[model samples]
Target: MSAALIVLILLAVLAIVVVSMTVKIVPQARSGIVERFGKYRTTLSAGLNIVVPFIDKVRYVIDLREQVVSFPPQPVITEDNLVVSIDTVIYFQVTDPVAATYEIANYIQAIEQLTMTTLRNITGGMTLEHALTSRDQINSGLRGELDSATGKWGIRVNRVELKGIDPPPSIIDAMEQQMRAERNKRAAILTAEGERQSAILTAEGDKQSAILTAEGQRQAQILTAQADRQAQILRSQGEAQAIQTVFQAIHDGNPDQKLLSYQYLQMLPKIAEGDNATTWIIPAELTKALGTLGGTIGSIPVDGGGSKTRVDYDASIEDDVAADTAATNEAVQEALDAAKAAENPATTAADLPSQEEPPPPPPAGGTPQA
Candidate 1:
């Protein structure tokens, strides 16, 4: 019983070692390459895999999933002889684990070196400005070359990207200054254009204002002239109506020559009232006007029972003048009496000189003697 128990324990120990060596637990999305006597063989996939325990061995483990590799910056010379430091990132995936494990000694290093060499070659054809601006083209070129070169090695380059490209500090400063100058120039041009537009608008506004003012003035003048003309027309109409009314009143009343002469005499004072008058010539027909006035007054109908006696200026004036003249220096006295009567009728009548009364008593005696 003791010998059997020891044998069972030894067999269990051997089984544990054999199991540990024969089975491999491969993680998900991973591949293990197997080698027989240091020679190429098959690849192990994910999950539990079995291999010949002594002669067959898992040489290398490769991740079938995509991987990322970042390369340090490398200095490259451009066509313009400008040195620029460029860093790159490569995305690759293992398609065949056998080739990824055995085809290349170090696939990561190889890819990185290839990336650097490819970047140098591509950038060597372009100036610094072009290299900085044309990053997509450089990336595409590198990816294409790398994908083709790694195809046999069971590596697929999914993408090649330039992480950064840094120019010299002096070049960066010069570019910044150039950009600022360009911006200033554009700003100045825009400012000038704005000012020009503003000036043109102001001038247009002023011109329009002036034209409108002139038009308004013209309209105002026309209106004023029309108003003045209307006023003149109204004044003339009023004057004409006044003259017609006066003429109609005179015709309707049929005033006599005495009334007409009185009105004419009243008008004479008004004509001489102003200092601007130069001449006051009496009418040539004054004699005819006086005769007409006398006739009109003598023919006037008396109202009530008033006597219709006519004035005889010739007899009264002749007798009085002859008598006064015979008594006191005949011719001289007659001239004096005529002058007094012509000057003022009331004063002359009261101042008539008394003649001798013997003529009245001798009148009867002379008739008997005769």
Candidate 2:
């Protein structure tokens, strides 16, 4: 009985070991590589997988999902002999688990090395500025080279990226200064252009304003000249009418010497009242005109006078009487001349006698005997 129990217990222990070794459970997004006697046999997928117990072994369990890897900065020399530090990131996936297990010993290390070499080659052909600015080109070259080289290793390089590129501190400062100077130059140019445009606009505005002002003044002057011309014409017409009326009235009245003498005496004071009467010239006919006016009043016939005998007033000096007579005769002659001149329709103020002239020498027969 003891020997049977021992054999059954041993069989059960062996069965558990075989089951544990044959059945493999792989997590999601993972693949297992089965090796038969140290040689690659087949690949195991996720979930339950069967393998030869104690003969086949799951050597590698590669993650089939995409993976990201970031590399540390590495110094590289550019075409211009400038050294710069660059870091990169790569995204990869395991497409074939069998090839990935059989091909490269360490596919991750190989991919990293290939990426570094490819990055150096791409940057080496460009200047520092070009290398710094052309990240997309560098990434493309890295991805192409890495994908092609790693394809045989069952690794697909899906994407490659340049994480950072750092130049020397001195070079960085110089580039910053250059950029600042460029911005300042652009600002100055824009300011100068603005000032030039403003000046042009201001000058144009002033020119237009001056032209408009000149136009307005010209119109005003034209209107003023027209108004003055009209005024002058009207004034001339009024003066002509007034002169004609006065001349006609004078002829119809036909007054005697006494009436003419009285009118002359009244006009003397008015003439003296002018603003320019500083040196008034008393005409020589003034005394004779006064004497004629006094004689007419004195010769008025009264009820007691015999036929109103005309009395001649005598001056205190004989020389005065002679001068008065001469002035009176000259006045009477001027009156005759004025009457004849007045008959002409072309008579003007200039045709009138200078001083006071007696009324048409009482028509030769109408003269009173003094």
Candidate 3:
């Protein structure tokens, strides 16, 4: 019974060991590399995989999914000899577990070192300013180089990216200042252009206003001159017609010298009605024509009844004016005559001064001679 128990224990221990060596659960997205006696043998896919218990040895368990690796910042000297710190991230996947196990001892470390070297080489050709501004170009270049170099190792560099690039504090400040200065320069230029446009607009407005004013004045003057010319032409035509009508009437009626003389005398009062008239002249022909007017008036008919009688227009006007005022002026004249008779001796009508008497002496304080 003791020997049988010992044999059962031995079988159980062997079974556990064999099961441990033969069965493998690779999990999802994982692969296992198996070797026979320290030599390349086979690879195990995800899920239950079987191998020889003793001869086949699972050497490496490789993750087949994409992975991320972030490296610390590295100082690189640029073309201008300026040192800058740069950090990077790499995304990669293992397609073949066999080659990934044998080709490189540490693929992650190898990738990291290769990335640092490649970064230095690429950045070394560019100035700090160019490196700072050209991140996408640098990322693409690193990705291309890493993908090519890592291909043989059964590694696929899916993508490479720059995490951060930091320059000196002084350089950052200088860049900020330069950006600020450029913005201010643009603002000033725009302001000047706006002012120039405003001035031009103002000048154009004034020029247009002046031109419109002058044009309006010219049009008004033209209209006024045309109106004045038309009025003068009408007046001249009217005067010419009037003169022709008057000449015809005189020929038909056969007017004597008396009518002409009387019409001429009547025009004298109208000529004196001028506002600016200070002096006027009377023609010498008026005196001789008055006698003809008197003789001709005696022969003219006094009324439509064909009664011929001599009529004095001046004497008739004087008689009518005296008759209207005689009653009202009689009291005033009697008072004046009585007052004068008291102040001086009573004199007859013959004692009054006639046109033949000599003129009295000039009053004192009269106007001086020019």
The better-scoring model by TM-score among 1 and 2 is: 1
Residue-level lDDT of model 3, residues 1-370, one tens digit each, is 6999999999999999999988987888988888899997888888999899999998888999999999999999999988899999999999877778899999999999999999999999999989989999999999999999999899999999999999888878988999999999999999999999999999999999999999999999999997786565555444434443443344345445566568768987988999987799765776766765544432321112111112222342232333424432543343344345535534432443332442353345552110
Show the lowest summed lDDT stretch of 10 residues, model 1: 301-310
Per-residue lDDT of candidate 2, residues 130-151 (tens digit): 9878989898888999999998
Candidate 3: segments with Cα more than 4 A from true spot: 1-17, 227-261, 267-288, 291-370
Assess every candidate by TM-score. 0.70, 0.67, 0.64
Off by over 4 Å in 1: 1-3, 221-256, 278-370
Estimate, for each residue in 56-124, the C-alpha lDDT of model 1 and write its tens digit. 888888888899999999999999999999999999998988887768999999998888888899999
lDDT of each: 0.74, 0.74, 0.75
User: Total clashes, candidate 1?
Assistant: 1
lDDT for position 369 in model 2? 21
